[model samples]
Target: MAVQGTPEPFVEILMSTVVALVRRDGPDLSARQFGVFLTVYLGEGPHTVRGLAKELNVSKPAITRALDRLGVHDFTHRQVDPKDRRSILVQRTVKGAALLREIRAIMGEAAAASDEAAPGGATELRRQHA
Candidate 1:
């Protein structure tokens, strides 16, 4: 329990979000898998396995493993870059977009609840950082 008028710690909100996500009805992605998914979808596009590895500071194989799981759910797919066949670009899918929306909604709801519990806190991470 945080002070009624102060910001909730980030971990508390994260844990609550994870709990909420876990209780939801959908494929459960590991931290690495979710991280990869978010980086590809939320961040800039034209993402590649190599680029994802570098961005996430993990090995190409590690990213590949996470992609394997994401691909099973059709959350993302890889296509040979038309401009550079040597590179493989990770592409998003409709299902992936939907999942992203669900995730955002869950997070927003969690944040809003946190805001209500602690009146001084912002309901979004961007505002907290700013």
Candidate 2:
């Protein structure tokens, strides 16, 4: 066992590093925006607005507002599902995929940096190292 005087690992360090990295990268979308983008892209469409809201654990208006932001960038488009005309589906545009690729690259960098900075954090990866 390690000495108790050693500084306990904290997730805040990783979060701060990620936030700084994001700022340095000048992201097209904020963290929340990226979350919305990923939720849709990863979901692969034909999902109702309500379903997405539920999946994201956010409110309907929150999803709608996020969609509105995405529309402004032409990152996504909304369409009424044929089977359920009243329900809308969020589809990612080419631009959205390109943006997502950039985000993923940045995230990968952050992950690597975090691992390097915290060789043995409290997280599972650190446990493996231990």
Candidate 3:
């Protein structure tokens, strides 16, 4: 079933989660890097640099740059596509999965906290702003 609410709460939760994650002493990923990381992990496998660029509506070089940072942290890796010699495939690492799990926990906590802070939750928040 679809969750009923305006987009504001979700955005707020995301912002809070990002802030909390950044505040923690860990790999601090840029927004683009985080986007590329999530797209590779949360989406389908065997993702190509070109495919990621298309998915994110960005240039291939931008994807490459993000991958470079992710690679340094061992959060992701790239390999030549065996099927297509010209293509480079983005692959995930155990560390990436662990990081994502941690992020999920943070986001969940932020969502719960936001819900508790506002009666009727995001719906009420939206109404107040309206």
Candidate 4:
């Protein structure tokens, strides 16, 4: 396990995972779009554009733009909030869940490969760089 406060191992794992994911052929999402997607799926919903904007520290227009792209991919959908006609709720779809699963699998494979490549796993890789 990584020692408390040291982010090297975590960074290494994330970098490797991103590299592996980027190499795959599929919808290439922008950073904002990816962030919105992750937030919607991983967070408690029903999410609102305004809520997401606050949580993500961005403008409502920014969240809406990201949601626009996500909607085009069918990864998410928006609905009129019954309680508040002025608000829209972001909802997840089966396609989004499937994509999340695929991303998880890709990251797992990349992490395993990274572990196998080093003698002492991420620690060893860090030592070499240090």
Candidate closest to the true structure, highest lDDT: 3
The reply for model 4, stretches above 4 Å from the true place, is 1-6, 119-130
TM-score, cand. 4 vs. native? 0.82
Full ranking by TM-score:
1, 3, 4, 2
lDDT of 4 at 109: 71
lDDT of 3 at 20: 93
Q: Which pairs of residues collide in model 1?
A: none
Q: Residue 100 in model 3: shift from native, Å?
A: 0.3
lDDT (Cα, 0-100) at 66 in candidate 2: 84
Model 2 residue 37 lDDT score:
81
Q: What is the lDDT of residue 55 in candidate 2?
A: 88
Query: Could you give the C-alpha RMSD of every candidate to the true structure, in order shown?
Result: 3.0, 5.1, 5.8, 5.3
Candidate 3 residue-wise lDDT, 1-130, digit = tens: 3366556676879889989988998989999999999999999877999999999999999999999999999999899999999999899999999999999999888877888876477656657879
Whole-model lDDT values for every prediction: 0.87, 0.72, 0.89, 0.86
TM values, all candidates: 0.87, 0.67, 0.85, 0.82
**Which tens-of-lDDT digit does each residue in 1-130 have in candidate 2?**
5456543443444465557556764435666666788788887666667988898898989888888888898888989888888789888799888876865776566666655777655454556556
Model 1 stretches with alpha carbons more than 4 Å out: 1-7, 123-128
Q: List the residue pairs that clash in candidate 2.
A: none
Listed per model in order, the count of residue pairs whose N, CA or C atoms clash below 3 Å is: 0, 0, 0, 0
Predicted candidate 1 versus true structure: per-residue lDDT over 1-130, tens digit per residue? 6676454555567878899889988889999999999999989988999999999999999999999999999999999999999999999999999998988887778777777876665545447678
lDDT computed for candidate 1: 0.87
Give candidate 2 misplaced runs (Cα > 4 Å): 1-31, 118-130
